[model samples]
Target: MVLAFSTESLNGLCSDDQLELLDAIDHLRLQGIDHYISLPQIIVCGDQSSGKSSVLEAISGVPFPVKSNLCTCFPTELVLRRTPETGVTVSIVPDSSYNSTENGLHKFHEELDGFEGFPDLVEKAKVAMGITTLGKAFSKDRLRVEITGPDRPHLTIIDMPGLIHSETKTQSKTDVRLVRQVVRSYMKQPRSIILAVVSAKNDFANQAVLNFAREVDERGSRTMGVITKPDCLVEGSGSEKAFISLARNNQVNFDLGWHVLKNLDSETQKGSSLLNQRNVEEARFFSRGAWKELPPSMLGINELRKRLSDVLLKQIAFELPSLIREIESGLDESREKLKELGEPRRTYDEQRLQLLQVSQGFQSLVEGSVSGSYDDPFFEDAQSDKGYEQRIRSVIQNMNKEFADEITAHGHRREVGSKSQTPDQNPEYVTREVFLDHVQSMMQRTRGQELPGIFSPLVVADLFRQQSSPWEEIARGHVKKAWDSAVKFLELVIEHVADPSISNSLLEKVIRPALKTLLTDAEVKTAELLKSHHRVHPITYNQEYAETIHFPGSHSREEISNIVRSFFGLSSISNGNQYLNNNNYNLSRLVDNLSKRVEPTTERLAASEALDRMLAYYYIALKRFIDGIAIEVIEQKILVPLSDILSPVAVFKMPAKVADLIAGESWESRSKRQDLTKKIDVLREGLGTCERFVSSRLKDEQNSQQEEAAGEDLDTSDLSVGIPTASDTEEAGVV
Candidate 1:
């Protein structure tokens, strides 16, 4: 079937199944059917004169033509199926492989001859098979052999042409063509299975049959191997023993011969034996007309027929389904081949365009990065590929690191996906503790993925690259852009071999995208950090962390400060020696908070408590800063005026529950200063006098008050809210 439609039209006509079949065919061509176990297509094949007939008889246990007459000309299909009464019997018919041809050769195979023709026919068949039937000049009718009866289980055996390799003296083109046509037909069934009949005759070079076999079936592995002529090895001939060594070599060389069966090396089979001296020399063995009275293994004609029939029957059962499948697959493949032959010009153009786009993308990528300059002798080295391979390996290593970090960090380093949550570090130990934690945290971060070292190589190399000399930059731009440009090289490295440390997930997902993202992010973070670098950078740290939290408030401020200096090995910014502020520990609370936050999320719940502790430290420090400032303002500003209006206890009585703590009692140890307390009390009386004075001033200066408020809508409730008492005269103080 030629698929002549445009892609759109083809899409319209194709059901999902057809498209899927097309896809499967495409995949099969690349990987071969080895990817799957196909049902067996057992093709029972042999040459014109080989004992394929007797073999068929023995295995099927049914009478096959015993004569030498070429009766099976066209290919025959014998489907062995089971039924209740018969147990199993083959359903015989001509396959479509025979149907397509109009020649007399179509009816190629016929049951060869009668029992009267047996002895001579068997001898001639042996010779015909000795040389491949391929060179035989026989009339096409001589090639036809009829199908024989074979009982089997869900199997069909396509008993094909006997050994017809090109080396035969009696070979005929018409004979080869007829068999090949049958094979071609078999190929159509998708169920046709081929069996390559190798006689233990000349070592295993009979494998040369496969050269021709491949022309008929691409899946020659699906061909079951039939080691006919197993009797060639006889006790009297010293050469028989030499055949044993040949058998072993055959096993080693052709272990992958077929699909449904392992090749039958006569040497490998149990209970198998070589013929004795008398049988080896005798041209005619004792004769028998039938095999009903024969023993299981042959000493004479009856038993020999029984042996042939039995193995043939078993092999027939094996070959049928595979033969059908092979035929069907070939038919399907031919249809595809026809469609490819008829593909439209526009389709070719579109494919060309797609190819061009891919090529251009590849070219741009290579030119920018991976490809070498004309001057780089390493890239141009003709004598050795070592330099080229090394360059590629280096690019791959760097790429693996780039992608590994991106994935481990979950696409962005700033994101907190793979970090240690509560890293063990003592706040007192400071520098080494924190530094150790950083390294440990980096390692811990590596654990989030299966490949630790391979996936996340230290991209701190990026910083070195950034800080390199200008000449180095120029050199890198020329030689190493492949690693940096990434996507192209990334894809290559991933498909090729890689570091055991690298994860496939990182390559496909992370490294490819991160190179672009990091460049953008670096620019952004740099600009933002420049804005307030002064204020933020000048702050001192309280302390570096030790391996354990030995000083989570375990030590005092002075001790922690000393720890910080000692841990970092920092000298003090001497008081008169120059720094603007005496207080140290100026780093932002957020930075420390983020570092602890960025630690790997511990796997065990036991570490959550430590993370909580780390978070609490940040919260407490920030809280103290705000609370201390708030306390200072309350002591200096609000308490003075409010206290002047009432005694400490009187102030509490003002009745806004919120203000109950607003008096002198709000201060710790307020009683320690009596003068301050006494003044606070006297100020309450003075508040009443000031209220009177303010009222008189307001009465006289009403016009002045109007002038003061003339252009504004500001309310002074806060100003009066703290003033004084409940008398009618006290109204002036409230006002």
Candidate 2:
């Protein structure tokens, strides 16, 4: 019952140019290329009753249990290899549902004494595949038939389930979709060369094989049409003319072209041996009649086998590099998935190391954000203008510019003197007239003074108060914007460096509270800074303000005085009037003006000066605040504190159950990791096999070139490189 592969030498399997290439591909498959995807091979396809099984049987020289619908239900992968002795071995790659019953089923491989064993093998396969009930349902699982003999050609062809057009007793509506799906799956592989089988007995247009082939191979570039039962066509009938036209490459011209094979007629099929069928095929079909007129290469199963061997060799050679690239691509993706699954973190020591790595990485990322040295891959392609500190500074700078514009445009004076208007009308608005009235009212209240001309510090203080009341709210807006940016940056760092559970814990336990404290402190300090500047009567003044008042063309003091007076809408005065006004006697005029008619002009000047100083100080203060938030508030409070919170000690102090939860892999991830690991191994093995074959081919080509250069006669009998010789049969193999 045992049909194990005998330990006969298969080294010469690569002796012939065609066999060498085919053996290489077979080796790749044996290395498990299918686990990743489809591999390069010939896929035989046709509709039911299309003589597909006959063509396959002729090519492999094995009786494949050919029948009406029995043998075509499941895919049969025929693996043919040359041997010193003749034998057939059958095995099943069962479906998952049958796995329990077929456990250790490699022992199911059985040696066949004669063609009679095929029918029994077919019944066994049907039963094992769960199609024995009505036996019309199909299976996608492959029943591999390995045949080794002196007569067999070195080949591997997947004979797919025949395309179904209608349902049978055991078939349902779903069977039509299932059969077509299975057939198309093999045909759609770019590496699969389709052998589209069509019966010459049937109308050419009625066969679905050509249509299915065209679905996946639109150009017919890799599709070779095999017209079986050519004897069924009457010699001079319209069918013969049409088939002749097809054979002559006249109708539906395929790139690989059409081939005709004359199989045994129904009467002769029962008693004829495959050897006799192959002999009769050449003797009766190719010797005379319309088939005689066809090119010798386009007739018979032998020629088709030779053509397929050549075409498949070219295909495998062409697709080898691309196949290697695909496998390498898959390998890289698998490795990344394995990386995401990460190292096992079940033990205390493992958890400590894992947490430490996360802490170091997160700390480095946050520090990089502060220093503007972003080397992390996660930070790549982030908005160029949105560096952590740059974002905060940009917001504050924009707000400061808007605040300065608001002060200059509408904060110069107030409308307090108008009885028709009240502060309640626009609580946040102030105009020059209202501001001037307020200043005048304050001056009147403090007028019991040292002298009539003396200016009180209280008036300066009152003016400062009304103008800068809007500062607190504007500053608060800027603070909120900066704080939001800081939180976003922190989250980005954590997400890049740590697991999700660890990130959430750090955000809750360390970063959020620290950010809250720092933000509150920033708000309080901001208000205090603004209030301190308003407490004194112009305690600090920079010459930058006085220097701001010069007119472009002014020269002497008289000219400068005229420019200043004009700017304030004062009446024009000559140089002599300006000289008299420069005397100490002018103090009474100035005091008179400040108390009454010119009070509005005086307030405008004072308000303008106050706005300029406030902006200057704010520009400096905004820079300090951005630096403190990004570097101190966030860096020192939130980001810096995260190190200890995410430290080994903190992770250890956490309940063992919680730590396990944080480090545990999800079921999906674990499954994916194992699956990818298996896939990567399979792909690497396939890649290695193909690489060796390609390298071998290269070496052979180079050797041929060297021989030509040396003027040595090339052996005509050697055939093409990688094509085996008849003499190679001396080396036996069990495939």
Candidate 3:
């Protein structure tokens, strides 16, 4: 039987106001809030017997309501599967009933069933649920039994008042309506997947009972329909196909919400629906022509039970593609309506595709480099270069070049070192400066230098590497191609710096901060994926990568631009607009590359995770921005304008040189029109200072942590140097 969950639609399942409710439920689930509403406390209400107590007995394993006319005089609650180790726990948030006269009565029946000396309860009870009482309430009398479970049993499911009592219309009394409401409210919880037992005989009164079930089953995801008396209704005629039709239709008749268990078999089967569904069908092939007329129970419940061992196992067996498609559709709708930021490029799928190509490409390249003559068709210089050089540089630049102190320190220092020399001083600094000075001395040579840093050893060294491979020297006379590629990158860099809009000062200001922030943020986010337990290894993590998306901020142009500004501050004096656009593009590319390396499953997986992560991070980034702006706002509002504010480290932005190279000569003029090149140079200067402070803070934090971790006699040397210090940086960049 389809179990009737199929007809239920999750459409409009959650209202806007219910978002918080849903979120809260999702939160409880995360916390494993396995809580079920408890009862005497939970008086199930339905007219007459309505099989209410049968549900209670089945769920709680305690019998009640011997017949239809009998009132469970004691108002007893059966306890299911319990022990004494874990205390009985319940949560009761009372429903508002202050104005009702019924609320005035203190309903306590004083052990009417067993309390020998207690008086009967009034219409209502003064006893209430509180921190001290939790949800427990004491009645003067009536049936009340509490069972504690072995472990903290995941929540409680209570069967309250039987449908239609002798004295009350609701299974619960009017005085207990507040309590009933509370129980119903708890059942509505999003994580509380409910299995509501309904009578299958299909009577008008029983149908009303199903209506209540429908009303309570608001969340399509949480409600399931369970028909109890199949033996009476379909008898042996209920074949699997027939039962599935009936089971699947129950939701239609009963109003259960969406989310059908795909598998026909739910967790447990109380009766023997399978005897005929399975064995009867199987037995039909044998000499069962006469036996077909017999009920399996005629033989024995055990034999009937044996007929259903495998067939009765409750499993969700719907086609997975449907579920996946449904989820994806829901995700898309959610994304469009859910959050603040709308990023078309928010997905890492394209990036993942690129990474896949690169990963496979790099492996191929490495194998090619190592290939012996015997290896498959080795070419002296097999690389295709029409666009090969450009693509290579593109990948490297896309890798995001970092200019840590150590990087610049590499070729910085001059041949002449003063006594102030620290072994860690960057050699790049001295050498590059010397090269610059030499060019100036040969100012006559500057006319030919074409570029300010044209003769610099840094460029010369790069030039050399591109020309010679470990295995061969620029075979096929590709020397010009390599030189041309190098020259192209150089031109891109020089033109960007020389742009009139870029002042050395502003360049100094924005360059370091933006780039540093971008790269580091990307790294941190990428690291989060790598850190996920699902990742088998760092490199292999890419194989398992997926993307998620959500909006974090408004789609308003101004608001979005502001987010961009807060994230990638412009470097120029005017802080032109194009720079912002260009920066965004580059940052996106870089973020994508890094993210893909962390998780590179496939197009679909990439899109999903990229979207989720974007939503998560954008929220975080916006929060950071708000905090930062708030600090400034508070400072502005205060009597004393804040003299000090924590300036977060600027992540590495796409370098202007690289951006220029990407733009090409023509793309440069228009692309960098408002670009801030020289301004970024100043940013670099500020970054130097920021780096120093951050480094000091990091060192202090490390030292403090180490000291705390150390014993009284611990040696300083006992602490191993971990992450390289700010000034003392490590070099891991591509050559």
Candidate 4:
């Protein structure tokens, strides 16, 4: 299975320095770095039965089984390495979709001294992947074959299952979708170079792989077109000329350009020495046909090997800096996850210490929120819903403002007059005349042995109690709102500081009961504040009460006299002088006139005065109630108690058994920690590999510059000579 090309020619395809670069990346891939970060490699994709396997065989000298039907069912990675001895190591890298115990796929491995067992090895891999006996038509598992020989080119090429157009009985629609998904996944890797293979025997426009390649590599910068089976076309025919045009990079131009490879036909599949014979036939067919018009470097497998090697090397060099950064970022993420999972807590003392640490962190955050000292990163985005919820003081302040507005707007049972700026549209509003009539009736019913112009204090107290009835409900609601906010903020803090298992237990056992008790106290305090206004008589020491009581408008003497006469049913008396003459007025007559005259006037005056006093006292008490509820119930009872509910001191006071019950690690937590530790170790190793590669690359560049300065001219035309440095890559606008 040796290649037709000589050892010297193969060595010239890629330099030792370039091979070392590929080796570094390949080493990381073998370590499973690809699961975390995409690496630079070449992926060969084509439509079914497009001679894709034949092209791969001609290039790598591995005898891929070529048949009339589809041959490859899964992706195969060919890792070609240059070594003094020839050997092959085949292993199955299980897909992340499957567990290690799935059909024992993870245990599949084999070694051989040559390529004779490769086909048999592939069959064994399919069996291991459950594709042979089980009804599974395709698998995401990759068959990785590391081939080492003196003449092999240093390259890693992945041959994906050929893209299918429709579903047959053997290949269901699920198979078609799975194959497409698998191919797209590899192509979507930003660093992969796509080798899109199409057959000249079929219509080039109908090939699906070209469309897929264009979708992922829009500018064609990373895609190279490979036209196989050029011998299928008739010489000098239109199809031949068309494919010749395509081969010349004119019909379907790619930035990496197109390459023509002639693969073995069906008749040649049964023969020995296929690689040697295939090469000789490919040279003969292209040398005489219209393909001869193209450059020698774009027509054969020999140049293709060199081209692939150079492209892979350049891609690695271009992407190395970013790759290193990605690895470092992944490493940091793994470390942070491990830190969150924390060390294992298997004993009572260990669990207690962990719980105490979590409590201290939670208390620090809660205290910061309650005090409005939001310096932590958790409080960064204050405009988002979660961010606003985390800042307890700000949220409470907003809620308090809303509560005050509600009390001011809706606290009164009656809006007594048109003096209200925005008249109350509610059913409780009553006009001044109507309200005064009701008050006069009430006074009459409750009249005591007071003088005519006096009304009992009990009437005013009854009106005040009814007017202030809405206060208790509004205040109670405000207290409950604040309590709910505090509870939410505490829950968020616990989630941030403790592991899930510990946080859930602590909330159910300790934090929730304390919050409930605090809420009850807040509600009770609010009720007490309202009761003071409800049950007691209206009283205020402020001098504003006197200022607030004044006659609503001027009253003329004629109006008063008419009102008196109408109520007393008396005939008109002489104007002013008759009543003023003391001699003419007898004592009995004067007393009767005086009693009737004051009765009507007394009732009207008493009602007006009562309305004024009730309004004044209502406003004074309204201000006091708003302030008391905001400060005493919400701030003191609910918010201020939040920091102490889960403080370190509380944890210290808890019994050892309680601490163990609340903080014991679950099986899931322990398993996650172990997994994260393993991932962190791998990421650290990956970072080291990337850094060393970059360092060596820099040293090589410096050495090259020094060599050039010493009168040694390097070949500037060579593809390897122009690999962009890190700075050059940035200047070229590579991300």
- All candidates: TM-score: 0.25, 0.66, 0.24, 0.66
By lDDT, the candidates rank as 4, 2, 1, 3
lDDT of 1 by residue, 1-735 (tens): 111111221122223322222222222322223112233344556655444543443333333343333335434333333223322111122232333234333322223223334334433433333222444433222222222222222323445555455543444566666566554444444334455555545555455455555565564433444445545545446444443333333442332231111122223321112122223322242232121122223233233323333333333233323433443454455445433222221233433332233334333333433333323322435344433443443444454454333322221112113344433311222332343344445445544453423222232222112111122222223223432433444354333322212224334433444444543443343233322221232222445334224533332334444555565566642323222357555432322333342224333222333332333333333333223322322212221222122223332233433222221122222222332333333333333333444355346346545757787565543223211213323332234
Clash counts for the predictions, in order: 106, 17, 105, 0
Q: Please list the C-alpha lDDT of all candidates, in the order they appear.
A: 0.35, 0.63, 0.31, 0.79
Please give the ranking of all candidate structures by TM-score, highest first, separated by commas. Answer: 4, 2, 1, 3
Best by lDDT: 4
**Positional deviation of 214 in candidate 2, in angstroms?**
3.1
Candidate 1's C-alpha runs over 4 A off are 1-39, 84-152, 165-171, 180-194, 201-203, 206-208, 213-221, 234-242, 249-252, 255-735
Candidate 2 per-residue lDDT over residues 1-735, each given as its tens digit: 122222221222223535666767787776667747668787889988787877766665544544545578788887776678777778876543444344554446777755456667767877776676656488877788877777455668788887888887667778988888878877898889898988888888888888888888888889999888877778889998898888776877689999988776543554324445464656576788877888888887667766876677667656666676777788898888777666766576676677667777766665555555656675655456444333333444454566445434333233222334445332344454554455556666765553544446556556556555555565566556656766776777767787665567667766677677767766665555555655544453445434543321112234445555666566753333334445533432443334332223554444443333434443343344344434443344433443354445665576756555565555665566667777888888877776676666556666777898999988745445333222221131101
lDDT of 3: 0.31
lDDT of 4 by residue, 370-481 (tens): 8999999878598799999999999999999999998898888777545545544332667767887878887888889988768888878877887888887788888888
Instruction: Write candidate 3's Cα lDDT for 117-215 as tens digits.
Output: 121121122233211123323221223333344421221234443333233433235435433444455455433334444454444333444455557
**Model 2 ranges with Cα > 4 A deviation:** 1-17, 35-38, 67-70, 81-136, 145-154, 233-236, 264-278, 285-289, 321-355, 367-383, 388-479, 495-664, 716-735
Q: Model 3: residues >4 Å from true position, as ranges?
A: 1-47, 65-96, 99-144, 149-155, 162-193, 204-206, 216-219, 234-244, 250-735
